[model samples]
Target chain A: DAGITQSPRHKVTETGTPVTLRCHQTENHRYMYWYRQDPGHGLRLIHYSYGVKDTDKGEVSDGYSVSRSKTEDFLLTLESATSSQTSVYFCAIRPDRRNTEAFFGQGTRLTVV
Target chain B: AQSVAQPEDQVNVAEGNPLTVKCTYSVSGNPYLFWYVQYPNRGLQFLLKYITGDNLVKGSYGFEAEFNKSQTSFHLKKPSALVSDSALYFCAVRDIGIPGGYQKVTFGIGTKLQVIP
Candidate 1:
């Protein structure tokens, strides 16, 4: 798991409710990413953080937001949850070595009703 | 835009037989390719990567991928398939030259490899 943890492994929420997923890493890696896994879509990045406070949107950033108050924690928030947002969310840390594969955390399955 | 493509939705191979999972990429600049395997209900595990130097990069679990610049491919191969090798495989590509901001790492739709025993 590379010291990465995603909280609330499984959750079911009502539509239009606010939900936030947490990604905690002890690897001290500089790069942290938020991704969602869905059918027909391998893993789409929602957002990523380069440093403690530096963050950027990914390809599928719409309807979602991320915040990184500290280096070890990266949070993904869905302001208004929808059925379309139901999927498995994964958090990953880019390896320190250049051009290497990133380490992933156990996914959090979120179901919107 | 940089992207990765896994043409096949699934690949099936018999135990002890050779197996190949195809992957191709389209990138603006020099491509940094990678392969990751995901077991059922588990996180993705890094299998191998092709940055530069050698065309054939060997990785964990006796898996290897060949980088073909002309074909724009980095296909994952294994000499002998094991039942344990049955899992979902994903190919990803990212540009090395991007500095700061969103270093977009695009992933393919993933191929499910089923090794029958």
Candidate 2:
């Protein structure tokens, strides 16, 4: 509801293949984040971008990478997908202001075989 | 590192009964707390947040969370539960200070709330 959209609502891929998930926002927020949701892990941050070309690793960034070339789009890529990388991915955006709320995308369900 | 904990994995309540989902947080400084709800197959929806000011914060869908500094807790509450209220709830926290900026939020494992009809 916050002008956020995640492409490829559902995806299924085999192990060792490359996968990419895209998040688009219209709010022009300064902060964008990629997160993965597992059954017992809740949601863990994978990567975040403070601005275009400015990104940082999150708690769970081992198997994933992110790029934010423009203010509206942030992409997450899994170089060589594995079964353990299968999860629901979500994108979040927030303003630069401290303590501001973050908005989430609908989520992409990725299954690796 | 900032972290959040939702002690209960599942909570069951009858319709019209009061319901609560517990959450506790740990951080270096005063933490910014938040509650979010997620329906099956949907994204997380913002419920409420405790930035400053009043300890009692009211959020969407008749939900409220009380921020207790002494206990380091922010438990979500509802006066009467409804079948429609059944969903997964998550608690999150962010530290006030970080090198780059406001630290990224850390979410709990989530609590599944089931309101029986």
Candidate 3:
């Protein structure tokens, strides 16, 4: 409801194949994040972008990459998918303010076979 | 490094009874704490936050959280429970003192709440 949209709400891919999840925002927030949710693990950060073209790895960034070419779009790429990588992926954005709450988009459920 | 923990995996309560979902966090300097709730097949929504000022903060859906600095805890509470309140809840924290620390909010393993009628 924060003007954030995630594409391909559900996806299945073969193991070792490439996959990308897209997050688009209309709020023009300076921060965007990618996270994966798994049972017993809560939501683990995959990657995040603080500003256009500025990105950083998160707790579970291995085997995943992200790119932010413009303020409106951030892409999460799985260079080579694996069964262990199957999880619900969420994209979030927040205003630059220090205490502003982060808003989330509908999650993407990805499966690797 | 900043982290949050929700010790309970699930909590059960009867309708009209008071309910609480505990959360503890660790971070350097002053920590900004938050609580969010998620319904079935939906994204997480902001419930409340503890930024500064009052130690007691209230937010959406009649939920409140008490921030205890010495204990490093921010536990979500509700006066009376309802069946509609059943959902997964998460606690998060970020370091407010650092300028770049606000970019990400680390989450705890969610606790599923079941309110029975």
Candidate 4:
């Protein structure tokens, strides 16, 4: 564990409802990322933040938004949840160094019905 | 953009037998490669990484990976497989020469390793 915690390890929400997943890190790393894992497709990056209030989208960032107000917290928001958005979400943190590996949280399993 | 690929969906190996999981990557410049393993219901754990220097890199849990620049591959190897080694493995890559303040690591689809007793 790299001092990372993901809230609501498991969640269930109705389709079209709003959902937010939180990732909190204590390491004070400059880079943080949110990813969704699905069968047949490993881990797809949803969004990543290089610094506070600085974020960028990934390959599958559609319908998903992220906000990093502080160094420790990175929030991923699903404006309108859909069945396709149901997956295991992971939050990762790493130092500014490129050669370093990223540390992951336990992961959040979300289901949209 | 840097990308990684795990061609095999699953690999089976008997206990005490050598095992390998394939991974290939594409990057324009020098690539930083990594391997991570995930047990059931847990987060991914870092296994090893290939930054530079030697082509062979060793990491946690008796696992090693050979990085071949010519072939564009980084294949994980183990001298002997154990039942406890069965898990989902992921290969990730980060391109250092990318024109950006941050280089995101892209992961492969993952390969399931089953070490039979």
Model 3, which residues run further than 4 Å from truth? B99-103
Best by lDDT: 4
Among these predicted structures, which one has the highest DockQ?
A: 4
lDDT tens digits by residue: candidate 4, B1-117: 678899999999999999999999999999999999999998999999999999999999999999999999999999999999999999999888886566778899999999999
What DockQ number belongs to candidate 4?
0.80
Model 4 bad stretches (over 4 Å): none
The Cα error of candidate 2 at residue B90, in Å, is: 0.3
Reference contacts reproduced by model 3: 0.73
lDDT of each residue in A9-107, candidate 1, tens digit only: 999999999999999999789999999999898999999888888888888899999999998999999999999999999999986636768999999
lDDT by residue for model 2 over A13-76, one digit each (tens)? 9999999999999999999999999998999899999999989998889989889999999999
Assess candidate 1 and give its TM-score to the true structure: 0.97
In candidate 1, position A68 carries an lDDT of 93
Q: Sum up the clashes in candidate 3.
A: 0
Residue pairs in candidate 1 whose N, alpha carbon or C atoms collide under 3 angstroms: none
Q: Could you tell me how far off, in angstroms, the CA of residue A27 lies in candidate 4 after the best superposition?
A: 1.1
TM-score of chain A, cand. 3: 0.98
Clashes of each: 0, 0, 0, 0
Chain B only: TM-score of model 3: 0.96
Q: Per DockQ, what order, best first? A: 4, 2, 1, 3
Clashing pairs in 2: none
How far does residue B7 in candidate 2 sit from its true spot (Å)?
0.8
lDDT of each residue in A66-110, candidate 4, tens digit only: 999999999999999999999999999988756799899999999
